[model samples]
Target: MATSPTTTGPRAPAGPGKDDRLTPRGKLALSLLCAAQFIIALDFSILNVALPVLGDDLHMRQADLQWAVTAFALPSGGFLLLFGRIADLFGRRRLFIAGLVLFTLASVLATAAWGLAPFLIARALQGLGAAAVVPTGMSLLTTTFPEGPQRNKALAVSGTILSLGYTVGMLLGGVMTDQLGWRSTMALLAAAGGIVAIAAPALLTDSRPTERPKLDIPGAVTVTGGLLCVIYALSTAADQGFGGLDVIATLVVGVLLLAAFVVVELRVAQPLVSLQMLRRPTVAFGNLGGLTTFSMMSSVIFLLTLYLQDVLGLSAFETSLVFAVQGAVLVGTGTAASRIVAALGARTTLVAGLTVQSVFTAALLFLSGDDDVWLAVTALALASVGHMSAVVSYGINATSGLPDNAQGLATGLVTSAQQLGITIGIPVLSAFAASRVGSLERAGEDARTALLGGTRTGVGVDAALVLVSVLLIGFGLRRADRR
Candidate 1:
């Protein structure tokens, strides 16, 4: 195999004469990639609304019901980086198509599952497929479109579809579970996956680096094991809190294994990921921005779900309607994200987006029992504009100035930040709210009011964290963006 030295250093933007327009093939490619992304996002959330109904039907214990969600999340979050690297070495398109087959088959299995054990196994297989698809799809996009306005626009569209998929899944899950039964939710995923799998081969071109560098076995094992442990521990913490012996022990082991992975990568000749890539301001701050926006925003949604349903007495469908508003706002924002990056550059767009998100999220502090729940809806809608813009810009920033050969590694970090953010957000932030609720209850407050207080505090903290991140990311990336 022919080899070129890998370089992740900063590079100048495309010259004025370079054509930034997309051809017809580009449009079709974008459509296929976006479809894959939508299915991945949909699978992540579609099961939430159907969980209780599915649990009763399957005769699952209440304590074990959370596993339905965790089982999918674990492999999806844990194996992202490893599979991402594999896609680069083996073949992105090949792995992507293979992932679709696995995902589609798993969905069918989940739909036809006769009991709890089979269902959980099928869900894990679905997650494993998702692990392969997400990063590979992203890398394909990055490779398909050059690093410029064209790629930025494509990413904006992809990110918008991702947000819409989650929202639609929430709403669709409720309607499907109510009208067609809980199994119908899994069937829907199977149908969507089948369609995408059939289309993927023709639409996607095979891509891999010229150099077939040896896979870093020690690094891959340690990192994959570390991530699995941490994700499992965090998922358990979400339900059981951080006080459980198992959760604490798992977290400790996870951290130690991750530390060892870092050490192994440093010594290995063909490291799974180049630590020096982290030295690039765009990669470093971009991942940081992505992690914060995703984590904090997701935490806010989880908090609102409980508050709206438990405290305000809204039905599941009604709560979905409130989120639908945010989805609409994101759609509008996505249309403008590329233009915003064109005008302000990715770094400024990122900082400005986070600032806007923080300001509106702060508005949620005014929320109380007396106020209309629409107050929460309004805040989220405004915040989502920032959310969508940040999503687009962080992606551009992260993948900027890297060689095509390293695009997979760059996108792996990008997708991993996103996956881990979503996984870690609910547990960590909800724990804060839970603590506040416990303290208030101990102080003789009523259950409803105490819960309300806890939710408010959690929202406030989320706002503050995002606000602080604005400064950190801005300063960190100041030198990275010269445009």
Candidate 2:
């Protein structure tokens, strides 16, 4: 077995009781790390509102519109584990800065593109950049702050910014696209990425394992290809339905590749992912909680956006304003998340936070097609408190008890759950909604009414799934706690 070092490079000075307080330099480092996280989150949603305008400008086919998202989602989600292990073997800070530079350059290309092909190429490059950044950045954060209150506090801030970035992107995307044109959205990302890239080397410390293990080429290839296939298939199934030959074939290939990955990992000398690390109750259930929170919330947001715009006849800007309230609530909740985790423990906090989100999401079932904007706003805001808490606690829970050398791999899994949540949520719920809407339309319902019915079904199912997660994680973690 490869041994980890006692300390993760040079960190802030901390004695017996002073471990929680960060020095000024430590604070600066945390800020820069969180900024990287914020930009990644921002990139995910910022281009969404601008896609239609971009399509018009680039003369993109209606079918090609979704590529803008999938292009980014594929590489970013697929390559996380590979880059994460690479960071552990090489250096986290080096990869982090490199990723930011790539992301910034990709954003510049996106801004300059006159057609769809170049723009998608830029988006894929951006995703590849993000794949390097997310896990390495997270591992840096964990390694910087020792596990406990200090780590929890840092995660609270990072998690808060992560969620806020997505919501802010929604608001800014509409405003920027309307006022300055669609290119401004990409320009904003470029500016943010450039600034972060410039600041990272000065603010962050580089760390790698004492012994460099050979990179797991077979495991890496299988897993990365599997995830790309799965994500691409899921995204396609959302638009074209699961019955298509392409979607079915892609999904089967993904599954087979994933199975091959598992077989390779079991036999390999140094696996890309350590199966032993995944068996820890905290690691397993914590990731499950993280995936559920992100996926359900994302699906809920997708349903709400459709409800606000298509069903309620609100403009894109108005729809964003509704989401903005949830963003504000998240800011406050994130600030308090550390205290909650300290008092209740990570497991309890995870269960409680997820339960709260589920309760509020269930309230969305009350929304009708006519006039329920306030209800949507209220449910969104209230649910954000739980969302923020879960996001904060799950990170704490997942990374807790792991060794310093494993930080990169552990954080990789945590971040991968997050990316997968975003990749999977919308498609699963959208497919259900599309089916429900088609059925309602066939039953003689009007377009608006059918849409509302579909959204309601998606929201209700989302709420129930969350409840199921509560039981599974709550009990699963409890058993682990007792042991």
TM-scores for all candidates: the values are 0.95, 0.97
lDDT string, candidate 2, 315-338, tens digits: 887887888788889999998999
lDDT of candidate 1 over 105-221, digit per residue (tens): 999999999998999999999999999999999988888776777788889999899877877888888899999998898898899889988998887777766579999999999
- Highest-TM-score candidate: 2
Q: Relative to the true structure, how large is the alpha-carbon lDDT of every model? A: 0.87, 0.90
- The window of 10 residues in a row where model 1 has the poorest summed lDDT is 1-10
Candidate 2 segments whose C-alpha is farther than 4 A from its true place: 1-8, 15-19
Cα RMSDs, all models = 3.3, 1.9
Estimate the lDDT of model 1. Answer: 0.87
